[model samples]
Target: MDAKQYDTLQQSLSPKPSIIKNCLKAFLVGGIICTIGQLITFFYMAYFNFTERTAGNPTVATMIFLAMLFTGFGLYKKLAQFAGAGSAVPVTGFGNAVISSAIEHKSEGYVLGVGGNIFKLAGSVIVFGVVSAFVVALVKLLLVTVGVTNW
Candidate 1:
C-alpha cells in the first residue's frame, strides 16, 4: 500500500542474479570471438602475403562480414542472448547492429527504409570513432610540435 511496503515487496519477489556465472560465460564467449579474429588475421598474413600491420584491415572486415551473415541467419540473436555483452563488445557487433536495423526496416522499401535506417544504430559508433581518432591525432600533433614525441 505504502511506497516502502511496495519497495520491500518488489525486492522480495525479484530473483537473485548469478553474477559470477554470468561473468564466466561472458568471458569465455568474448575470448572465443577474439581468438577467431586473431586466427583470421593470421590466415590473411600467411596466405595473402599481408604483413602483420596490413592484415588488420582484412581481419576486421572478415569479422564484420561474418557477423552480418550470422545476424541475417538469426544465429547472432541466440549468441547474444547466451553471451550477453560478450557477443556485443567486438567489431562484429557493429555489423550486427547495421544489418539488423536494415532487416527490420526492409518492409518500407529499400531507399526510404533500409538505406535510411541501416546506419541508425551504427551512426553513433562511426561518429564516436572519427571524433576519437581526431582527438588522438590532435594530441599527437601537439606532442610532436612540443618535441615530446615523434611521428
Candidate 2:
C-alpha cells in the first residue's frame, strides 16, 4: 500500500482522544451516580429510620427510576448534552433508551404502541448481558462437573 493509504488505515484503527474522553466521562458519570445513591442511603438511614444496608439497594433502584422518569419528561437530553457519553454509558442511558423509545412510539396505539418499542436500543444490551451471564454460569457449571476448575 502507499504510505498515505497506510497512514489513513492506521488512523482509522488507532484509538482517539474522544474514545478515552468518553470512557473517562462514563467513569465520572457512573461514579457520580453511585455517589448520589450513597447520599440517598445516608439520608434514609439518618432521617427515615432505615439501616445503612437496607437503604442502599433501594436508593439504587430509585436512581434508576428517577433516570427513567427524567427521560420520560425529556430532561435527560439536557444532561446528555453536558455529560456526553458519560450519560450515555450507564444504566441511566438504558432508562433513557427504553422510555424515549416508548414515548416516540406511543402514537402507534396500544399493542403497536409503547409496549412494543419501548426497549429498542436498550433491549439489545439487556439481552446481551443476560445471555452472557447465562453462558458464564454454564461454563462454570461445566468446568465444575468436569473437575477442571477450582474457584
Candidate 3:
C-alpha cells in the first residue's frame, strides 16, 4: 500500500482519546491532592502548635513523604495512569518522579544506581525550584529597597 493509505488505515485503527473525560479526571485528581495538602496544613496549624505561616514546611514535607511511600508501594503509578496529568502537576508528583527513577535504577547497586540516578528525572525540578526562589527573592529585595513594602 502507499504511504497515504497506510496512514489512513493506522488512523482508523487507533482509538480516539477522550479529551473531556481526561480533563475531568485530571482536574478532579489535582483538586483532591490540593485539598489533602490543605487539610494537612490545617492539621499542623490546629494541632501541632504551628502557625499558618510556619505550617507550610512540615505540610510539604509530609506530602512528599507520603508520595514517596505511595510510589514505593506501587500505588502512585496506578493513580498516575488513571488521573493523567492531574497526579503529576503538584509537589507530590515531584516526589513520585524522584522515587520512581531511584526505584527503576536500583538494580545497578546503591551508589551508582539509586544515588546517581535518583536525580536523573528530578535534577531539573531542583534547578528550577532554586532558580525561581532566587528570582523571587531578588524581586522582593528590589521592592524592599524602593520602599514598596516593609520587610
Candidate 4:
C-alpha cells in the first residue's frame, strides 16, 4: 500500500485502551490465581495440620482435582467466567480442559467417549514434551561425548 494509506491504517490501529485493559485484566487474574494458591497453602497448614512441604505440593494437586471435578460437573465454567485466566492458567485449567472435553464426548459410547476424550488437550502436549526431552537428552549426550560440554 501507499505510504499515506499505510500510515493512516497504522495510526488507526495504534495501541489503544482495549489492549491495555486486556493486559491489565490478565495481570490481575494471574495475581489472583497466585493469591488463591497462597491461601490454600496457609489453610492447609493451619486447619488440616499438614506439614509445610506437603501443604505446598499437595494443595496444588487438590486444586487440580477440584478444578477437574468442577469442569466435569460444569462448575468450572463459572469459575473461569469470574476469574478469567486466573483460573485457567494453572493445573486446574489443564484438568478443566480434560474433563470438559471428556464430558462433551460422553454420548459416543465408552471407548471413544471416555478414553478418547480424557486427554484431548493435554495428551498431545505431554507426548511431544516427553519426546522432545528424549531428543534433547540424546543431543546432550552426543555433545558430551564430543567434548563440547561448556556451552
Candidate 5:
C-alpha cells in the first residue's frame, strides 16, 4: 500500500476523542485537588495556629507528602489515568513523578538506581523553578533600581 492509503486507514481506525467530556473531567478533578489543598491550609490555620501566610509552606508539604504516599500505594496512577493533565498540573504531580521514578529504578540497586535516577524526571522541574525565580528577582531588582517599583 502507498503512504496515502496507510494514512487514510490509520485515520479511519482511530477513535474520535470527546473533547468536552474530557475537559469537564479534568476541570472537576483539578478543582477537587485544589479544594483539598485549601482545606489542608485551613486546617493548619485553625488547629495549628498558623497564619494565612505561614500556612502555605506546610500545606504544600502536606500535599506533596500525601501525593507521594498515594503514588507509593499505586492510587495516583489510577487517578492520573482518569484525570489526565488535571492530575499532573499540580505540586502533587511533582511528588508522584519523583516517587514513581524512584520506584521504577529500585530494581537496579539503591545508590546507583534510586539515588541517581530519583531526580531524573523532577530535576528539570527544580531547575526551571530556580531559573524562573532568579529571572523574576532580577527583573524586580532592575525595576527597583529604576524607581519603577518599591522594595
Candidate 6:
C-alpha cells in the first residue's frame, strides 16, 4: 500500500478514545483513593493518639499494604485497566508496581527471580525520592544560613 493509503487505513482501524469519559473515570477513582487515605489518617489521629503529623506515616503504610494485597490478589490490575492513571498517581501505585514485579518474577525462584526483580521498577523511585528529599533539605539549610528563612 502507498504511504498515504496505509496511514488512512491505520487511522480507520484504530478506535477513538473518549477524553471526557476517561477524565471523569480517573477523577472519581483517584478522589476515592485519596478520601480513603484521609479517613485512615483521621482514624489514627482520633483513636491511636497520633497527632496529624504522626498519623501520616501509619496512613501511608496502611495504604501501601492494602495496595500490595490488592496487587497480589490481581485486583489492582483490573482497577488500573478501568481507572487508567487514576490508580497510578498515588503512593499506593508505587506499592502496586513493586509487588506486581515481584509476583511476575516469582515463578523463576525466590532469590534470583522475585527478590532480584522486586526492586527493578521501584529502585529508581526510592533513589530519586531520597535524593530529592536531601536536595530540598540542603536548600532549606542554605536558606536558613543565608537568613532567607528561619528554621
Separate clash counts for every candidate: 0, 0, 0, 0, 0, 0
lDDT of 5 by residue, 37-102 (tens): 999999999999799999999999999999989998999999998888788888898889999999
Worst 10 residues of 2 by lDDT: 17-26
Where is model 5 more than 4 Å wrong at Cα? 1-9
What stretches of model 1 exceed 4 Å from their correct place? 1-5, 147-151
RMSD of each: 2.0, 4.3, 3.3, 5.0, 2.0, 2.6
Q: Against the hidden true structure, what lDDT does model 1 obtain?
A: 0.93
Give the per-residue lDDT digits (tens) of candidate 3, residues 35-85.
Answer: 999999999988898998999999989999999899999999999998998
Please give the TM-score that candidate 6 achieves against the real structure: 0.82
Q: Which 10 successive residues of model 1 have the least lDDT summed?
A: 16-25
Q: Tell me the spans in candidate 4 whose CA falls farther than 4 Å from its real position.
A: 1-17, 41-57, 81-84
lDDT of 2 by residue, 1-151 (tens): 9999999999999977677776777778778876777887888888887897788667766777988789877889987876787787766777788878888898998578888887777889989999999999999999989999965
- Screening candidate 2 with a backbone cut-off below 3 angstroms (N, C-alpha, C), the clashing residue pairs are none
Better of 1 and 3 by lDDT: 3
Instruction: Provide the lDDT at 117 for model 3.
Output: 93
- Prediction 5 TM-score vs. true: 0.87
Q: Using lDDT, give the best candidate's number.
A: 3
What clash pairs does model 1 have?
A: none
Tens-digit lDDT track of model 6 for 72-120: 8889999998888789888888899888989999998999999999989
Of candidates 5 and 2, the better by TM-score = 5
How does residue 42 of candidate 3 score in lDDT?
A: 94
TM-score-superior candidate, 3 or 4: 3
Per-residue accuracy of model 1 over 98-133 as CA lDDT, tens digit each: 999999999999999999999999999999999999
Off by over 4 Å in 3: 1-9, 131-151
